[model samples]
Target: MNEVYFPYFDPDFDKLPERINGPTCRVCIDNESMDDCTVVKVDSVNKQGLLLEVVQVLTDLNLIISKSYISSDAVWFMDVFHVKDEHGNKLTDQKVINYIKQAIGTTRETHNSAKAKTYANMVFSPEPNNNNEHTVIEMSGTDRPGLFSELSAALADLHCNVVEAHAWSHNDRLACIAYISDQSTHTPIEDPNRLASIEDHLTTVLRATITPTPTTNQPNQQEAKTADFLGGEGAVTNVERRLHQLMHSVRDFEGPPSRTASLPTTPSDSESDEEAGMKTTVKIESCDEKGYSIVNINCKDRPRLMFDTVCTLTDMQYVIFHASINSDGGYAFQEYFIRHLDGCAMSTECEKERVIKCLEAAIERRVCEGVRLELCADNRVGLLSDITRVLRENGLTVVRADVETQGEKAINAFYVRDMSGNKVDMEFIESMKKEMGPIALQVKNDTIRPSSPERSRFSLSHMLKASGSLITLLLSSNPCKYS
Candidate 1:
C-alpha cells in the first residue's frame, strides 16, 4: 500500500528529516508529436475550482488554450491542454516549464507569496454594426491573483464566448481588452437586455476586484446597521443606493477584543464540540521572505464557495498569487498566498485578527442565514423580474441569487433573508413556501398568464406617474389628449 502524505507548511519543521510518499501533482510538456501547439498534461487530486485555477495560471503566462480534455473520477483529475504562447508558437522554454510545474505542484498553503501592485478602472461599450462581428470590453484595475480568472468566469457565466483577449500590467496597474460574442448565436450581442445583464454582472465582478474589505476588529453597530439598512431594502433603487453607501463604510477598527470577550462561550462540553464541528476557521500568516501573506481556510463546502471566497479576498483588496483547493466528504480546505495591493503586509496584529474574524463571519452568515429557494420553470422573458417581485412583496430580502437557463428550462436559486438581516425563522419559511408553491406550480403547468394590452398601458402609466416630471412633461405635450 502506498502511503499518501499531505504537504502542509509546518512552521515547526526545521529540517528535512524523512522522505514521505504521497499524492503529487504531475505536469509535463509533450512536443514530439504536436506541431501547431504545445501539449501539457496534468495529473492531480481533484478539487473544487481546480480547473479554473489551472486555466488562470496559463492565462497569466500569456498562453492560449486551443483545445483541452478533462477527466475526473471524483478523487483524481487528469487533463491535457493544447496551448500556445502569444506568438502562436510551441512552448520550448525550460524555465517556463519549470515555473508551470512549480505553480501546479505547490499546494495553496505555500503559493502566491509575491507582492505586485495593480489598479484597474473599467469601461464597457457595445459595438453593434449589424454584421454580427464582435463586442469589445476594456478594463483597467489593480492587478492581483486570479483577476483574469474572475473576468473569464464572469464571461462564461454570462454566456459570452471569447474570441480574442489581450492583457498587460505595468507599474501595478492592469488593463485588459477582450472581444466577445453571444454563445448561442455566435454573433455580437445586439439585444439591449442581454447586453445590460452582461455589463451588470461583469461590473460586479470587476468592482469586487478593486474594492478593499473593511477591517473591523469588533462589530460596529453603525456598520452593522448600515448593512442591515441595505439588506432590508428590497426596492431596486433603495437597495442600489444603500449598497453604494455600504461599500464605502468599511474602515480599520481600533483594537482587538479581550481574549475572553473574543471567544464564544459554550454551555457544555458536548454542545461545544457540536458547535466547533460546524464552525469555519480562517488563518492568515506572513511569508515575509516571499513578500506575501498566507491564508488557510477550512469550512463546510457549499455551492459557489470558491467564488464567494475569492470575491471576499478581492473585495478586501488582497491579491492571491497561488492557491491549492480541495473539497472532500463535506468539508473544504483552501490555501491562498496573498498580499495587499499596496504591497504591504497587514499593518497591525489586530488587522490580521480582523481578517480572520471577518472571513469567518462572512462564511457563517452565508451558511446560516437565508433560505435557499430553488425554482425550475420554462424559460421566459420577464420571469425573473416577476419572481423577484413576489419575493419583495413577501418581505424577503434576497441576499444572493443565481439564474441560469438550460435549454427550454430555467433553473433559478435564491438565498433570501428576512428584513432584519437575519435568517428566516420557521414561520417566515413556511409562509414563503406557501406563497412560492403556487408560483412554482404555475410555472410547471404553464398557466402563467401574459400581460394584457390594457395591463401594459396601465403599467406604462404607473411608471410615468412614479416619475412625476416625466408624467408632467408627457401631459403637457398632449394636454387635450390626456384630458
Candidate 2:
C-alpha cells in the first residue's frame, strides 16, 4: 500500500474499533491519511486563535467538524473532525489523518489513540433535549480563512441571537462553542418544517455536517450548563428544557461558493488585448516605533499595472525593519513582518500615514504607465539562465536583478543600467517586454536612471536567494499556482 494510505487499515477487525482515538486531536496516529482527526485542549485561553486557524484549514480541505466542547478554563477543550469517503464510511487512513493533522496544526505533538477517541466520543454523544429555550451548537474542524466571517454573517441574517461564543485553535484545528437562541420565539421552533429549513441552511453556510443532541427525561447538570452557556435565556422560562432537546441534532455548515460569481477577474485571466503591467516586491528595513503605517492605492493585478502593499510599525517607530515583494502575472503579492526595539511605543497617527504613502509611491512609480501583460508560472532551475541570457543577448546590461516565485512561476525584474549610468533604451525595453509577454514577463525602467556606481553595484542577490528557495521546496503538494 502507498505510505499515505497505511493508516486506514482496520486493526483486529473485531469490535468496531472505537470511532475515535488519539491523545490530543492534533496528534494523529496515522502516518497516511487525515480522514477524521481530533484536537485537544482547544478551550483554554491563548488557544482560541488556533481553533480559528484550524477551521480555516479544514474549510480549505473540505472536511467538517463533527463534535467539539469548551471546558472550563482549567480543562482543555477537545474537538473532533471526521473524514468520510464517497460511500460514507469513516476513513481512518493514516495519510488522510496526517494531512488533517498538518492542516489543523496538530501533527507536531505525540499521538494518543485512546485519548483522542475518548474526547471525540465525549463530544459526539447524542445531545438530547426535551425543553425549548436555546440551542447549543458545537463546531470543529480544520481551519481556513474567511470561515468565521461567513458563519457570523449567516447567523446575523438568520436572526439568531448568539448569546455566548467561544472559539479556540489547537494543533491547527478550530472549534467554536456557540449558544444560539431564537429571539422571535413567539413563533417557536416547535414546527418540524421550519426547523428542517433552518437546519439545512446552516449546513450549507458552514460546509460542515450538523448533529442534534437528544433531550433527556430528567434535568441534569449538562442541561443547566447549556442554559448558562446560552446566557440565562433572559426572561424566558424553560431555557434548560429547550437547550437539552435542541442539542441533539448536528448541522454542518458548508463554506462559501467555490467560485463566486462576483469575484473580479484576476490579471492572469485577462486577455492579451488587455493592458500590460509590472509586479515587484520591495524590502524595507526600519525600526518598529509609534506612528507608522503602510498603504496602497489603485494597485491591482495586471500587465504593466501597479501592485502595491506596505509595512509600517507604530510601537517602535525608530526600530529597524526590512520588507520584500513578489508577483504573479501582472499582480503583486507581498509578505513583510515588522519588529520593534525595546520599550518603543507604536507610531503616532501622522507617522503611520507617512509610511503608508512612502511605500505606495515607491511601488506606483514603476507601474505608472499601466500593466500591459501578466501571467503565473512555476519557478524552475533554468529561470535565471533564461533571464540573463535574454538580457545579455539583447545587449541589455543587467545592473541588478530581483526575482520571486508564486506557485510555479518565477517573477524576474532586471534593473538594466548602461555602463555610463544612463538607463537602457526605451525601445529596447519595449521590445523585451513584448517578447517576454507570452511567458508572463514584465519590464520597468525607473524614469530617473541611476548614475552612481553604488546604485549599479547593489545586487539583489540575497532577495533572489530567499525567493528561489521557496520554489525549490518539493513536498507532497497540490501546487495550486495562482498568478
Candidate 3:
C-alpha cells in the first residue's frame, strides 16, 4: 500500500496538483500524493471573496499554507493548497483533520444557486438566545503611549475581568477587540447602563494623551473614541481577521505617517521591512485593455502574504478577477488583476494612491512592533489588568497584544515599545524575567519573521502563577524571532 497520498510542503506554492471537480466547490484532501504536506484542493464556481474565507478558515485553524495553486477564471474557481501544521509537520492528528473537514471540505454544507451549486464557506450565524459568557468591547482609536494600560485599568476599576483581547496599531491608529465579563458573576455585562458606562470611560481614556506620565485627561483630536459593546459570544471570534477589518474601518492608513507610525528605529515591521536593505513595495497600474487594475507586490517571503493582500482587496471592494502568487529566492511575488465592485478599473491617481497605501498598511499591520513578551501563567481575575499596569509602570507602550486562556493557563503576548516608540532595554527584559520567577521567561532572537512567533514554553521549570495570585511584568522588544 502506497503511504497515504499526502504531499510534502513547499516553502511557498510551486505548482498546483492536477484535480477536477464539478461546479459546486468540493474540497478533496490528498495525503498519499505529495511527500511532505497535506494537499487540500477546492474546486467550485468562483466568487469575489471566497478565497478570503477559505484562507481565513485554514489560517485560523493555525495551519500554514506552504504552497498553493489558485485560479478563478471564467465561472470556475479552483485552489489547491499544500498545508502543514505549525511545526512544519504533516497533519496526522485526527482532531485537526476533522476541523479541516468540518470547516471547508466536501463534508461542508452546500446549497444550490439557480445556475450552479455552491457551498456556504462559512456563515457564522449567531447563536440564538444563549446566555453570553462575556461582553465584547471593540474600538479603533489613536495610537498613543500607555493607551492599553489606561484602558485595562479602567476595566479593572469597573470590576470587569478581561478574558481575551487582540489589538494592533499601525500608522498612529489603534484597533482592538476585547472580551470581558463581570468580575463577580463572570458573565457578560448585558446591562445597557453598564455598557454605556464602559463606552464613556473608554472614550475619556482615548482622548487623554501622555506627556511623560498621564496626570490628567487632555483633549486629543487625533484619538478616536469609537467604542461599542455586544454579547460575548463573539469571544470565539477570529482575532487577527477581526483586527484587520477594524483597522480598515477606521481608515487608519489614509493619513500621512504619524510619529507613532514613522518611527523606523523601533523593532517593528518597518525595521524588518528595511532589513536586508529591502522593503515591501506595492504598485498599482491600470490595464486599460483588460478593464482591470493590476497590483504588484514584492516583499520578503513570509506566510499569509496572500491572505493580507486578498483581505485588503476584498475589504476595499476590489474584485480580483485573476491573480498569480509565488515565492522565488526568498521573496514573494504577487500580481492581482482587480476591478472595483462597479466593474470599472482604477481611473484616477487618487484611487491608485489610496489602494497602494491601504495595501501597504495591510502588509505592515501584522508585523510585530517593539518586542514580544509571552506570558504562560494561571488564568485569574484581573490578570490582564495587573500585567498592563506593570508595563505602564515601566513606561512601556503596547502596540500589539494577544491575550487568551487555554484551560487554566493564561497564554498572553505583548509587543511593546518605550514611551517614545523605541526598542526596550535588555535590562528591563531581565528584570521582568526575574520578577515573574526563576526561569519563568524564554527569549528567542527573531532574525526573520514567521507568520507570528510561537509562545516559548517553559517546560523544564514551568514557573507558572497559581490561581488568585497577582502577577506583574515589564516588557520591551520582539524577543522571539525566527532564527
Please list the C-alpha lDDT of all candidates, in the order they appear.
0.49, 0.34, 0.66
For candidate 3, the C-alpha RMSD (Å) to the true structure equals 12.1
Model 3, runs deviating above 4 Å: 1-23, 106-131, 210-237, 255-257, 260-262, 265-274, 446-483
Task: lDDT for model 1, please.
Answer: 0.49
lDDT score for residue 122 of model 2 = 19
Q: Write the per-residue lDDT of candidate 3 for residues 1-483, one digit (tens) a residue.
A: 777787789754432332334336577788888898898888767766677767766765556676677777677777888887656788787765655655564312331101110111112221222225667788776767678877888888889888877788777778878778888988878888888888778877876663333553543333323234321322222446567777877677775335544556333564543465547799988888878898999876666667788888987888887777767566778888888988899999998999998888888787655676666667877777777776777667787787766567677778877675455665556644655565444445434333222223221112334444434343434532220
For all candidates, what are the clash counts?
A: 14, 151, 21
Candidate achieving higher TM-score, 1 or 2: 1
Task: Write the candidate numbers in order of decreasing lDDT.
Answer: 3, 1, 2
By the lDDT metric, which is better: model 1 or model 2? Answer: 1
The TM-score obtained by model 1 is 0.36
Least well predicted 10-residue stretch by lDDT in candidate 2: 112-121
Candidate 3, position 326, lDDT: 69
User: How close is each model in CA RMSD to the real structure?
Assistant: 20.6, 28.8, 12.1
